[model samples]
Target: MRKLTDFEKQVIEQKGTERPYSGEYYQHDVKGVYCCKKCDAPLYRSESKFNAHCGWPAFDDEISGAVKRNIDADGRRVEIVCAECEGHLGHVFEGEFLTPKNVRHCVNSVSMVFKSALEVVAPVKKTELATFGGGCFWCTEAIFSTLEGVNSVVSGYAGGSATDANYRAVCSGMTSHAEVVHIEFDPDVISYESLLAVFWQSHDPTTLNRQGNDSGPQYRSVVFIHSDKQAESVNAMINTLTKACVWQDPIVTEVAAFDGFYPAEDYHNDYFELNGEQPYCKIVVKPKVDKVKALFAELLKSN
Candidate 1:
């Protein structure tokens, strides 16, 4: 963990607020991730931040499950804190109409440290690829991206016949494509079997072509294996899970040969990271991410 400065200690530990418009990030615009100063848990993304002209830096969203909300001791406003370390993070206000999200997270700049995306993604040594589709790529990507050995997770469409596969074309449910994530990881640090375990636990494979509110062929549960060995491994895991009666419903997750993967547009690469405050991310993605963190705490990156 990084050592916190006195100012950061005051704001994050003592729950003090910075002077209005005085914080460094108030007028700063940078594409990166804002992590908690105390524990380095990712808190917010630069894209969700907006100028609220409220003195302190303002964000319209936070990384899913990164911050927790509680009523103030005074019983008036809501206080936000880092979910991982319980460090103070200022407050949250709703219905302000400050942005399309209609929410504002008034945060003290000292409570966070910014890391550009380039710095966050480390260079890989002999990386391997894994592709999977479990409902929405937004949720799947968010889950796998936090794992210890994962180098990158790109949202994309796979197993489709459509030559021109795009979000709009896939969403129409006629393209036969399922929203998938192309993961690049280091096998030396994390085994493919471990990744397979995460895949089974992260989403319900029994549900045919649906996950939560979003339902279509694009949301199907699938594992696109890159090799024959991968296929055998997936089948073995499925058989074990089935014998264990992990779910009352029969396992329906598809294990198929590898196919071409069409990467989604740039905006979709980090959907949960960028739009976590949005209703879909908040309601659908957050809980699943929290569960993954709890279940796979040993596999997560330290930071």
Candidate 2:
């Protein structure tokens, strides 16, 4: 609400370029929120973050759509700005930080604020993303978000062509979109493989283009891999399962890198979670939840 306190002042502005804690991007280190110091727009989460010698908060990634970047005033520099209010944040550099992407976003801490947590997670701040398609994003997103490590699961249409689509178009089986859930999770506690494993088990992958009675190309069994390694990993898992005779029939799941993911209409998100008491919720989602609990007993919370 107000300017940062004195200790905050030192961390944000007092550090020199070469000192140990001087250029330290992550001080609290475990888990915290990184927000715009100017407008308080929530920016980075601590999970995808790593320590960099960069003279500002160096993160491997940002909370999607919270902040944005454009070529800076220097024209050569890519300017990072608060997507909420266009407040100047900092610049992005490459070949400097080391991580999966080898990218660094050098954001001035003066441009950011931090939040402390009484809970393990400060719900007020996060930068999280996870995607899944469980036949009708409504059903898919509803099931996943109930589990731990899942922060936000948005229903969407992914791996599609250019243009807008709605329930009519998607249901028509012409949009080339798979119903998906963009999930955000705490990676430290759960690995991507675990999420993928949950995804594979959650829905009936044996069905060619449907879940339960739902049928159509829109309901097809597909896993959109976001990275090359993800493609290899998922493919390997499928191959291993095939070799082990997991499914009597070959897995017809489509494995491909994502070109794009388009979110479904607002009404679709949390359909099962909200409508759990409704007919579809009781008849459809509840039974599915039971199956997941039985199949994934190892993954279930002990409590």
Candidate 3:
């Protein structure tokens, strides 16, 4: 029963922060049961663990004496308290397994030290967040809502003829508002260039003051780049599109230095999901969704 070194403890804590089940901690495959580091209460038998890739060690079930279950402070039903001395462990949930027991004991890897024989790598996270605006925040917003790796999509206005612009004046095409969406994405799963490709295909950037059918300066196409790399990637794609004559009229999409982005009112967020039956959604948004699903099904999350 040797004490863990400082680095080992740090490793555990660091792995805990990355993601619940996304680290190398769970790559272990040996014949030893995992137990509480604090009190050595057997939390899981090695045979029960499976390759979940959630960054945490996952098991089909835990040894009965090794843990306790209780209601958490959030009022959500949870499991915790190691049996030996009642050390606080994380919660347990049901229905994750596709197999028989139909449950997963999603334990924090760091909380209990693994006693496996083989070496295991820590899991890593490879997701990124980005904000973008094209034109007609409504149109751009609606278009990106359908892509893959897109955890969530939100519409808002950015870069303007005026600060603190609203949907009305921007719709008037006077406040110089172009539609936009903030996208949460996983970089390991999708690339920004692919998203750019979707952006170009989803809207008519060739139109200077509009995005086909939605005529107005507010609806103009633009790429509000978040960083130098994003700017370079966007510019490279624009160059390729220009050389290839992807747009008959000429690429009007501007790669402007992104100053700032403002989140739109709550109601404006996820307009397509919220107002699926609305007339604009049916006519404008639905077609975009259909096109994305047909052309970019590989990038979408499973329903």
Instruction: Tell me, by TM-score, which candidate is best.
Output: 3
Among all windows of 10 consecutive residues in model 3, the one with the lowest summed lDDT is 9-18
Q: Give lDDT tens digits, candidate 1, residues 1-303.
A: 668888888888888888888887888798999988889899999999998989988899999999999998789999999999999999999998999999999999888889998878744569889999999999999999988889999999999865858999999998878999999999998888889988988999999899878899889899999988888899999999999999999999988888788899999988999999999899989899989877787555441
lDDT of 3: 0.70
Q: If scored against the real structure, what TM-score would every candidate get?
A: 0.58, 0.56, 0.59
Poorest lDDT segment (10 consecutive residues) of candidate 1 = 294-303
Write one digit per residue (lDDT tens) for candidate 3, span 1-303: 336556434533232233554544567777877877665556788878887666667777778766777776678757565767555556677866544788776676666777654433334766665665555566567677666677777777777744646777677777766667778788877788778878877877787876667777667777777789998898888889899987678878877777666677788887777788989889877887788667676545432
lDDT of each: 0.90, 0.71, 0.70
Off by over 4 Å in 3: 1-126, 161-163, 298-303
Q: Can you give the lDDT of residue 55 in candidate 3? A: 64
Better of 1 and 2 by lDDT: 1
- Residue-by-residue lDDT tens digits, candidate 2, 8-29: 4453334212333443344557
Could you tell which candidate, 2 or 3, scores higher by TM-score? Answer: 3
- Give RMSD to native, each candidate: 14.3, 17.1, 13.8
